[model samples]
Target: MTELLYLFDDSTECTASVLSCLPTGDGLYAVTLDRTIFHPQGGGQPSDIGTINNVSVVKVVHTPEAVLHLTDHEVAGEVVLKVNSEKRFLHSRLHSAGHIIGLVGDQLSWHATRGNHFPGEARVIFEPQDPASVKLVDCVQFQAQVNQIVTQAFARVLTENNGIRTVTWGNLPAYPCGGTHVKTLNEIGQVEIKKIKLKKGQITVSYALT
Candidate 1:
């Protein structure tokens, strides 16, 4: 099994070190590693972009057990892979921000259905149960409180309960989430709810970082 570096009990950069590389096909290779902090394209978040052995990784796809990094060209030696920390941090911030908004909606008696992360130009969409319950004024109030919570520098505690990853936002919202998140809410910084939609008794709230 592959060891996830991010799963470790430490605060460090989200990167990984290559352990061994073996040819898999004519133009493809399977690179194994000791540990990796790269949060692969899972939980609706996109995979990271960066270099591996000086060759740019075109894509990273997550599987059941390992995240495979695919490069444009084949390599022949020990390689160094550096994750785009900017992208990683952006995703982390947006993800946690989404969690905060989602939790707030739930507190308002609005049942959230699903959430997704749009990286680079980060965005989070939340499907609420009662469309009539969502209001522009309350949305503004929710965002203000969310920002305040982020400013508190709350830590994200991940725990395995019943074979699932639990992502707890601060001490307020603790739920099962398999996605990656920033260590603290303060790292998420400021967030804004750009728009909201209503249809079929369902409210959709969209958010962005400013």
Candidate 2:
């Protein structure tokens, strides 16, 4: 298994030894490293695009076996990896904001089923404990609740055991996650609840970063 460097911290660049390199397509290659700072396109977050040994990386795929870095050119031996810091920061902020929304749902006795943290398409899907809670999907009130959670200085805590990583926000609920995130809730900034919809006994809370 490739060492997941981003799971421990948010540093953007790292040097990793290339374990294997193979040609995947026309003038493209899939390179696997001993460790990776690139967060693959999974868990509702987009893949990290950057450079590996100066060759442009088009995609990063997280597979059941290892992380593959798709590059414009071939690379071997020890390689320098650099991720787009701005894009990564935005993705992390969006992801962390989704977690806060999940927390809000939990407080309302709703269980979060899924979430998407991609920019311009961020939202959380929840299964309400009571049908009455479905009526609480107010843009104004829900925004206030989310704002209240955001204003708090909650530190992001990560723990791993037996290869499973768990994330926590201060004394809030802990969740199993494999996605990238900010170090603290403060980095998420302001979250605007765009719309809330209830349909087929499920609630969808759409949001955006301001």
lDDT (10s digit) by residue, model 2, range 116-139: 888999999999878764646667
Model 2, stretches more than 4 Å misplaced?
A: 131-134
Choose the strongest candidate by lDDT: 2
Error of 1 at 11 (Å): 7.0
Taken over the whole model, the C-alpha lDDT of each candidate is: 0.67, 0.87
In terms of TM-score, the best-performing candidate is 2
- Worst 10-residue stretch by lDDT in candidate 1? 7-16
Which lDDT tens digits does candidate 1 get at residues 1-210?
A: 557665443333334556555665767565656665555676667776666766766556777767777666765444566777777788777877778877777766666666777754444444445555554336687787678777876777787867777887557767776566888778887888776666655667778888
What value of lDDT does candidate 1 attain over all alpha carbons?
A: 0.67
Alpha-carbon RMSD to native, per candidate:
3.6, 1.6
Cα-based lDDT at residue 102, candidate 1? 76
